[model samples]
Target: MSSRSYDIAVIGAGVIGAAIAAQLSRYAVRVVWFEAAHDVAEGASKANSAIACTGFDMAPGSLESDLILQTNPQWENICRALDVPLRRIGALSLAFDDGDSDSLRNLLNQAREAGIEAELIAGDALRREARTAAPSAIEALHVPREGIIDPIRLTVGLAKLAVLNGVELRCSTPVTGFRHHPSGAISHVVTPTGATAVGAVVNAAGVNADLITDAAVAEPFTMWPRKGQFLLLDRAVGHLVPKIMCTAPTPHTRGIYAVPTTNRTVLVGPTAVDGDDRGDKTTDGDTLDAVWARAERLLPEGVERRHVTKTFSGLRPASDRTYRIEVSAKVPNLVHAAGIRSTGVSAAPGVASYVADLIGAEVMELPVKSSVRESIPVIPRLAEIDTDVAATAFTARPGAAPDEHPIVVCACEHVTAAEIAAECRGPVPATSLDGVRKRTRATAGRCQGAYCSVGVSFILSAATGDQPGEVRHGEPGSHWETPVR
Candidate 1:
């Protein structure tokens, strides 16, 4: 076996792993990233509520609180450098009753303890700011730093930047096992292709992190899957809520939240359900109906189920306690980043920096590269293009190869065939329909790929040299065999 060695190897290409890999690439180190799935961010990263959380509601003195507080400011810098869409649109945790209002005051104190600056807005001021709030809500806590982000774009951007900096990313490569070298503190990771040796390994595998570490070293903790399902409203209702609207915090979950996405679509929901099932379960009609009922109570005239485009679910890797980020005491070179639940997306950049610091302290002579490329290539949006720019682009690349510029395939989201093609041909290219959907947003709109699935499948077939019948949805081993009528 021709063995490959690296300074660091990160298992799982979720948001946290991608962020860590991207940050590690800024230093002069050989980095290898492994994903069990066909693409990056296909797991918990793709399915969350997509909120850039401020540390306002995290448990005080917890790892999540620390990371959330540190990452909030770091996001602005990272988003700007990477061209990831992040809006500091703020949030409102509305209280509908007097008891809830009292709870809000308590939360304010907790927020202060967590180092989040927030204020309680009441009466007309609260009404004026968030007009869609239920009339019953007499007060609200306005967390000014809370924001919304495109999680997929952020993760993809980080992975792409890491790739440009010479980090080798291997998708469809699941690490089945690992062996510790007897002489040195190195590990030989076994993948589907072959084994690769590395000086150190970071287990950031979201829900499956514990399983990855179990075979080699004793896991420090365990992770439970907390499923959160979300409902996506059409763009027509996007203007009704200006900021991320939410309910008073609860002990089990964050409560239902209404958020306006960067793409001008409003989203609501994420009813938390605890389970061991890792697959994205079908959105139950009953669950969605309950969510909408709550949403109507929150926004009154703002929510309409008729405008509902899609519903999806994501699993959060909740632990018995708080998030765990530390090197294993049993294994010297192994680091475990597990139990990263809801706040992982917002806390990812800070987590990356923190992990880098930990890894750096152990290695004797690791040097930061003076000339590592910090900037990410910009992805031009078709919706953002003006008439003149569109004309110029069309002229530059004619319609005969119409997929070169922008051929609007998904009319609901304005996703172009070119964008799908580009994502399919990327460095760590998309291998399934859901992968394309996450990368280019081809199937995530009002129609949910009902009208455009065939076209997207054809595009995938053409791009990957696969037959039309061979193109599957996001999950591996599943194929789109049914011919489109």
Candidate 2:
């Protein structure tokens, strides 16, 4: 019904887009970030292995290697500013056979060229280093800079910081197309609501980038979906792997891996299933079985399906030319940051910095604002705090009314009514049951919303002023009544 204008417009609110938007906020400029999903990181950023590894084993001269190598070192400062959780536990690419050992040597050689510290550990040292690593693994390439992170927290934190820096985030605003000027520069962007006039445009649309580029008359940069099926084991299984354990990469795939997530859950995953649809997040039985079969080979104790709490999948924006981040040749003021595969989480900040520099040169150069806030407020999780402290803090809030029965909505995850209410009405409100689950952890426990879903739906209804039955489960066109099959 109404249209707005901006100095710049960024399409896609995944890690890449969020990082770009956040970085651009450092300067005094009008920027708008657009996301098609109900929430940020709803795609590959939410899934993936969630590992922030140095691009040690990447192709030495490739774009991905360059971006990751440059970006990996900045994570500490970035995470600190955003208040996101990060753990630098390191990783070991296990060599199961003599041939795999040869591959480890090659991977280490590449690491050396990339200036990353990757050591070859074998025999007694290898066995003692990873207690859970199988004895059959004769050697491993020890990558010291590899780390694990909470992907959801990282994406949300970046978006929040961007919002704080005066970057307007418009979630659920899908960019329909682009209009170009006579001189070949991007004139503005067309969204579902209305067109937004802009000086420049950045296409970080993940798998859907080709649609935007095609309309802009750029070279055909087609992207296909490369699905990675993964499993999340219970916290009890976290002790099974002391560090991020992985297998030597094959020619076609990155192989499978297991990690102890920062959240204290054992994450086993990433079967490199290629050529699936972007919307195909379906966890296939065959792929999952394959994933565990490979993952168990690297672990002392084999993993059983019984210990698995969640089975899910994420799609990477696979392309013939991966990590093709550059300014569009055909369309002026059009920057393209797409096809950042598995290492998106690690490479996001780097992408953002690069895109920001491009925008500063091409679009509008604005001075840094002195009043730009450094950090956004972080909410405390009740699950991590001491019970006594949480209880005392919960009741300490200044209020005249007192209730005899303090409502506890999610017993499995220990989520309470007050926490749900706060997030439902927070700066970036939860639009669906899954949105609330990601924000508050309600109905995301062992039972997987078996008991708390109805209550969460009721709370959503109250917060959004909708009828209880009208509460949706996830994204648009989805409802809570039907279970995921």
- Every model's Cα RMSD, please? 2.1, 2.8
Which residue pairs in candidate 2 have backbone atoms (N, alpha carbon, C) closer than 3 angstroms, thus clashing? Answer: none
What is candidate 1's lDDT per residue for 249-278, written digit by digit as tens?
766557888888988888888888888777
lDDT of 2 by residue, 267-315 (tens): 8888766774779888878878878887788766655678899998889
What is the overall TM-score of model 1 with all chains considered together? 0.94
lDDT, candidate 2, equals 0.81
- Which residue window of length 10 is worst by lDDT in model 2? 396-405
Q: List runs of model 2 lying over 4 Å from the truth.
A: 1-3, 386-392, 395-408, 482-485
